[model samples]
Target: MIEQVTVTPIAPPPAVPRASTWAAELRATFTLAWPLVIAQLAQNALTTTDVIMTGWLGPEFLAAGTLASTFLMPFLVGGMGIVGAVAPLVAQARGARDIKAVRRVVRQGMWASIVIAALLVPILWQIKPIFAALGQNPDTTLMAEQYIQIGVWMLFPALAIIALRSLLSAFDSTRIILLITIGGVLFNALVNYALIFGNFGFPRLELRGSAVATVLTNLLMFGLMLTYVLRHRRFKRFNIMIRFWKPDWPRFREIFRIGTPIGLTVLSEVGLFTAAALLMGLLGTDEIAAHAVALQCASMAFMVPLGLGTAATVRVGVAYGRKDAEGVRKAGWTAFALGTGFMTLTCILFLTAGPLIVSWFLDPRSPANANALGLAATFLVVAGFFQIVDGAQVVAAHALRGLSDTKVPMIMAIIGYWFIGLPIAYVLGLVLDWRGVGIWLGLAAGLGIVAVVLVARFAMRKRLGLMAGLG
Candidate 1:
C-alpha cells in the first residue's frame, strides 16, 4: 500500500547554514546536544525513580520490579529502535526538502509503533507462564505479573512519545521534548511518592503503585506531546493529522529495515552488560557488588556521550540528506571530539576520586564493606580508563546510524562484545584470575575494537547512501 500523507499548510524549516568549520559544526551540534543530554538524564531519572521507590517496599517488591523490568526492557528498547528510524528518515527528508516524505515517515512510524505496541500486550499480559517456564519462583512470578499488568498499559503511549520525539529531533525541535521530559520527571516523582506511600490519604499501593504512576505518567506525556505536535504552527505543516490512519506499507517496511538492526544493536549492548555482570558473580558477592558500583558510575557518566551520539545522529543524517560529505565528516568529528574530550575529563575525575566515588555507593564504615569498597574503587579506575573508548564507539556508531549503515555495525557490536570481548574476559578474568579488573579490561578492549570497526565503516563514503533506496 502506498503511504499517504496530507501536506499541511505550514512552511518548511529554514535551511541550516552549511557547517564549514569545526567551530561552526560544534556550535550547531551542541545547539541540539544540551537539550538532548538533559532529556536523556531526565529519562534515566525516571528509571531511577522507579527503582528507588520500589526498593522501599522491600526486597520482594524490588525483585518483582526487577523481573518485571527485565521482561519489559527488551520490548521497550526494540520498539524505540524500530521507531528510531523515523528521525533519520525525517531528517534526511527535511534536508532534501521533501516535506511529504517527512510526513509519511512520521505517520508510518506511528502506525508501525501502535501495531507493535498492541501485539506486545497479549504477550506481556500472559508472561507469568513464561516466568514459570523459566523456573522462576512462583510467588515472584505472580508479583511480577501484577506489576506488569498495570505497566503494560503504558507501552502504547511510551512508544508514541518515542516516535514523536524522533520526528521532532529530525526537525531540530528538541527543547519541547526536553521540557516535556523534565515535566515528566517531576510528575513521575510526585505520582510515585503519592501512590507508593499513599501520600495525602491515597491508599498505599507500593509495588502496584509504581506501575500505576508509570501508566499515568506515560499517558500524560504522550497526550501532551501529541497535542502539541498537532497544534504547533510550525509542525502543523507536516499534516500529521492528515491521513492519520492511512496504511503505507513501503514506508513501514523501511522503518522496520532501518530500525530492526538499530534495536538489536542496542539489545546486544544491554546483553553485553548482562554478560559482564554474570562474569562478576563468579568472583564472589563483593566482586559482583563492586562491579555493580563501578557499572552504575560508568552508566551515569555515559549519559554525556550518549546524548552526543543522538546529536551526531541528527547532524550526520541531515548532512547525508544534503549530500554533503564534508559536512558529515565535520559533524562526525566534532561530535567525536566533544564526546571524547568530556569523557576524558570524567575519566580523570573517576581516577582521582575513586575512593570518594566508591564511598558514595558503598558504606565505608563497616569492615565487611571495606573489601567491596576497595574493589569498587579499583573497578572505578578501570571504568575511568574505558570511558574514553566507550564515548568514541557510541558516537561513531550513532554517526554511522545516521547514514543508515546499521546491519554491519550491528554485526560488529555482536562480534566485538560477544565474540571478542566475552572470551577475552573469560580468559583474563577467570583463567588468569584477574577477577573484576580482568573482566573490565576485556570490556574496554571490546569497545575499542567496535569503535575502530564503526569508525572505519563511517569512512567508506560510498556505503553511506548506497542503501538509501533499501531504507
Candidate 2:
C-alpha cells in the first residue's frame, strides 16, 4: 500500500510516428496528382479552344487574341498566385485539426481575391492605351482591346475559382475540379461555335463573341463551383461565407505576404519566356513557328509536374502543420520522385518522337512547312534535356511553398531566369550565333541551376531554420 501510494505509473515511450512508407506515399501522391493533372489539361484545353476559334476568324484575330492573352495572363496569373496561398494555409489548418482556422483562411482568401480583382480589372480594362504605348499594331490593338474590355470581367470569377479550388484540394475533392473544368471546356466550345460564327442564331460577334463566351463560361463555372462547396455535406459545414463581410486583417495580410512573392516569381518566369519569344521573332517566321510548336509540347508535358507540384504543396503543407518533420520529408521527396519520373518519360518521348510530335502540330508533307517542321523537331530534342530539370525546380519550389517559403525562391527565380538564363540566351542565340538551339540550351541551363538550388534549399531546410515552426 505504501509502495502503491508512492509509485507513479511509468510513462510510455513517445509513440513512433508510423511514418508512411515510400510505396504508400507514392500511391497517395499519385492519387492526389492525377485529378489535378487532368484538370490542368482541361484548363489548357479551354485556352486551346479559344485559340482555335480565334484562328478561324483570321490570323489578325488570332494575333489580337494572342496579344490580349499575353498581356492578360500576367495579371491573371499573379492574382491567382496571390490567392493560391490559400492552399497551403488550408492544408496546414486541416492537418492541425483547426476547423476554425480553416474557415477563416478560406474566407480571407476570397476577400483577398476580390480586392486583387478590383485593382486589376481597371488596369486590364484600359488595354488599348497600354498596347499603344508598347507600339503594337493599332488595328490589332484595337481588336484586342475589344476582347479585353469584355473578357477582363473574367478576372473576378477566375480568381474566385482558384481560391475555392484550394479548399477543395485540401479535402481531396479535386475530382470536381476536373469535372467543372471539362464542363467549362465543352461549354466554351459550344458557345464559341455559336457566337463566333453565328451558327445557332447567336450574334456574329467574332473576337468580341469569343470574349463574351469566355465571360459566360467563367461565370457559369464559378457558379457551379460555388454551389457545390455550399451544398456538399462535407464542405457546407465550414460556412465559409457565413460572414463574408467580416474582416480578418491578419489573415488577409498573411495571404499577400505569402502570395506576393509567388506572383513576382511567376511574372519573372513568364517574362523570361516572353523575352525568349521576342528573341525568336528576330530569327525568322519559321523559327518563331517552330519555337511555338516545341514550346507547346514542352508546356503540355509541364502540366504533369505542375499538377504534382501542387499536390506536393498540399501534402507537405499538412505535414508541416502537424509538426511532422519526417512526414514533410517523405511527402516532398515522394512528390519530387513522381514529378521527375514522369518528366523522364516525357524527355524520352521528346527525344524519340520529336519528328512525330512536330507532325501533329504541322503537316510534314507541306513543302512550305518543311523548314518549320525540321526546326521544331530539333528544338524538341533540346526541350527533352530541359524537361527533367524543369520538373525538378517547379516541384521543389512548391514543396518549399508548403513551408510557407516564397521570398527566397522568388529571388532565386529572378536570378536564375533573368540574370543567368536570359543573358545566356541572348549570347547563345544572337551574339554566339547559335540561334534556336542556343536559346534552348540557355533555357535548359537556367532550369537546371534553379532546380539544383531549390532542391538544396529543401534538403537543408532543417539547418536553415525553415522548419523552426515544427512542434
Candidate 3:
C-alpha cells in the first residue's frame, strides 16, 4: 500500500492554439501560393522579354519562335501535369508526419520523370517532319526545327527540377522553388540577350540562341534545386540519390496509377488548344498571329487561378490526411471563392483594357496589328467568362486529386474536350466558318462542363469518405 501511494499522474501536452479555421486555411494557401504566382509572373516576363527583343528582328523570328514553342508545349505542359502527382501524395505524407513516405514519393517521382523524358525526347525529335508534313512554310518549319531540337534537350533537367520542386511544395517549402525559378529566369534573360543578339562575343544564334539560353537556365535551376534539397536537414538523411536510382516498384506503381490519369487530363486540355492553334494556322498567318497573341494573354491570366489551384491541392491534402471532413469541404469552397474572385477581377480588366493588353504583345502599326488586336479583344471577352469556370474546374480537380480520385476527372476531360469541345470547334470554326471566335465558344463549353463535373465529383468523394485511410 505504501509503495502504490508513490505514483503520480503526468500532465498532458498543451493543445496547439487552434488557428481560425478559414483564416488559417487562407493564410496557408497564400503563403504557399504567392511565391508560385511571383515565379510564374517572372517566368512570363522573361518570355515576354524574349519576344520583345526578338520582335526587333522581324515577324519571321517571332513566328518561328511561336511555332517552335507551340510544337514543344504539349510535352512540357503534360510532363508538368504528370509530375504533379507527387505533390498531393507528399502533402498527405507531411500531414501524417510520415517523412519516409514523402521521401519515397519524391524518389518515385524522379523515376517517373526519367521514364517520361526518355519517351519524350525521341517523339519531340521527330515532330519537325510532322510539322512540315502539316504544311508549315519552309522557313517556319526550318526555324521551328532548330529551336525545338535545342529545347527538347532541356526536358530531362526540367522534368527533374519539376519533380523535386513538387516534393518541396508538398512540404510547404514553396519559397525555395520561387527563389530558384526567379533566379533562373533572370539568368535566362541575360543569356537570351547575349545569345540572341550575338552580344559579348557570343555567336549570333538568334532563335537558336533563345533555345540555348532556355536550356542553360533550366540546367542551372535543376542544379540549384538538387543542391538545396541535398543540404536540407530534413531531406539529407533520405539518400534519395541511391533510392531514386533504384526505382521502388510499389511507389512507382502508386505514382503511375495516380499520375497517368492526371497526365492524360492535362494532355487532353492542352492538346485541344494546340489543335485549335493548328487549325487557325490553316486560315492564314494573320489568324495564327492573332491566335498566338490572344493565347499568350489568356495563358498569363490563367496562371493566377492555376496558382490558387495548386494551393488548394495542398490544403485539401492536409485536411484529408487529418481526417477532417469539414476541413476538406471548407478548403475546396475557399479555394473556389478565392479563385473566382481573382478571375472576376481579371475579367473586368480584360473587358475594359483588351486593346491595350493586345498592344503590349504587338506593334499597332504592323500589318497583322489590326487582326491581332480585334481577335485578341474578342478572345478576351470570351475568356472573361471561361477564366472563372476554368479556375473553378482546376481547383476542383486538385481538390479531387487530394482525395486520389483522378480517374473520374481524367475521363470527364476526355469527354468534355475531345468528344464535345473539339467537334464543336471544328464544326463552328471550319464547317460553319465562324473562325477563331467559334473555336473559343467550343473551349468555353468544354471548360464549363468540366467545371460542373469536377465539382460534383469532389462532392461525391467527400460523401464517400475518400479520405478514410488518411486518419
Candidate 4:
C-alpha cells in the first residue's frame, strides 16, 4: 500500500528593483563574509606564526617546516573539501526546515572525516621515505619527519573543525567560529614560544615544539566548537548528536556522492602547487624557501576571497533550496564581485611592496637568506598578476557547489592544474631555464584559464535558470 504523492508548485514572487536587489545581496554577503574572513585569516595566522618563528631558527629549519606544511595542507584541504559538502547540504535542508536531514548529513560527514583521518595518519608516519624519494635533503627530511609524527594526531580535530565550521556557516552562525580561531592564535603563540625555545622551564624541542603547539591548538579549537554546539541555548532544539551511533546508508551515500567530487577538485588544485613546491626543492634550499615565503604571502591574501567563497556556497545553497533563482544569481555575483575587488587591492599591495613583504619572512641581512628574499619578491609580483582571477575562480566554484554542481568543476580543475599548469611549469622552469618566475607564471596561467571556464559555466547555468532544481 504505497502512498502516491502529489506535489504543488508555487510561483516565485515578483522580482525586486535591480538596485535594491543588488544592495540587499551585497549587505547579506558581507554580513556573512566578514566573520568568516577574520576566522580564515586567524587560521592562516597559525601557519604564518609557524613560518615566522621557524624562520628565526634559520633557513634549514624554515625549509623543513615549510615542506612539512606543504605536504600537510594538500591532504588536509582535500579531506576538508569532502567534509565541506556538509555546509551546502545542511544549508539547503535548514532552509527547507528539515532537521532530520541536517542531522543525517552531519553524522555521515563525521563518519567520512574519521575514515579520511585513518588513512592520513599512516601517510604522515611514512612521509620520510616519500620525502627522500622526492629528492629532499636528508637532514631537513628527518627534521620534518619528526615534526609530522608528533603532530599528525591534529589532523582529525582539524577535519572536525571544518565540518563544524561548515555546519555553523550554513546557519549564518560565524561569530563563534571567528572567536574560537582568534583565541587559538594567541594560544598557539604562547605554546610555540614556550616549547620551541624552552621558555618557562619547558623543553627546547625546536621544530618539534612548534608541531606540538599546532597539534594542541587544533584540538582546543575542536573541543571549544563541540562544546558550544552541544550546550548553546540557541542550538538546543537542533540536537545534532541525538543519534550518536547509527548507520544510514542512504544519507551516507548522499554525502559521499557530493563530497567525492569536491575532494577531487581541491586535490587537483593543491596537487599543482604541491608539485611546484617539490620541484622547487630540487633547485636548492634558497629556491624552496623563496617559493614557500611567496606562497605564504599569497595565501594570506587569498583567505579574504576564500571566506567569501564559503559564504557564497551558503547563500547560493539556501537560495537553491528555496528555489529562488534571482537570489541565487545575486548571491553568486555579489560574492564574485566582492572577492575580485578585494583581490585587486591586495594586488596593488603585492605589486608595490613585493620585496619588503618578502623580506619579512626571511632575514635580508643574513647572506644565506638574502637570495630567498629576492626570488620571493619576483614570485609575489607574479602572485599579484593572478590574484583577481584566482579569487573569481574560487568564488565561482563555491557558487556552483551551492547548486550541488561539483563534477564538472572537478573535471575542469584536473584539466587546468595537471594537464595545463604542471607541464607549463616544468617546461618554463626546467627546460627553458626560467626557474621560479617561470613556475609562478605557469601557475597564474592555469588559474586564469580555470577562472574563465568556471565563470562561463556559471553564467550558462544562470542563462538556463537555476530556479529549476538541478538533478
Tell how far residue 28 is off in model 1, in angstroms: 0.6
Q: Model 1, which residues run further than 4 Å from truth?
A: 1-12, 55-64, 122-146, 275-293, 358-379, 424-442, 462-471
What are the candidates' C-alpha RMSDs? 4.0, 6.8, 6.5, 4.0
Query: What lDDT does candidate 3 reach at residue 94?
Result: 60
Q: Give model 4's clash tally.
A: 0
Clashing pairs in 3: none
lDDT at 135, model 1: 61
Clashes of each: 0, 0, 0, 0
User: Which 10-residue span in candidate 4 carries the lowest summed lDDT?
Assistant: 1-10
Q: Which candidate leads in TM-score?
A: 4
Q: In model 4, which runs have C-alpha deviations exceeding 4 angstroms?
A: 1-20, 462-467
TM-scores for all candidates: the values are 0.86, 0.89, 0.92, 0.94
What lDDT would each prediction earn against the true structure?
0.80, 0.83, 0.77, 0.85
1-471 per-residue lDDT for model 3 (tens digits): 000111122231222122357888777677878887777666676667666666656667776777788888888878877888888787666655565666777888888888898899899888668987887777777887888888898888888887787777766788888898889888998999999999999999999999999889888999999999998975676557764467567777778778788888988898888888777767766666667777777777777777777777887776765566677777777887888788888878878888888787778887746775677788877777787888888888888887777887899999999899888988998999999888888888888898898887777774566656433
List candidate 3 stretches off by more than 4 Å.
1-20, 468-471
Deviation of model 1 at 388, angstroms = 1.5
Q: Which 10 residues in a row give candidate 2 its minimum summed lDDT?
A: 1-10
Cα lDDT of candidate 2 equals 0.83
Residue pair clashes in candidate 1: none
Residue pairs in steric clash, candidate 2? none
Residue 65 CA displacement from its true place in model 4, Å: 1.0
lDDT of 4 by residue, 96-185 (tens): 556666667787788878889989998878889999988889998998888999888888899888878888898788999999999999
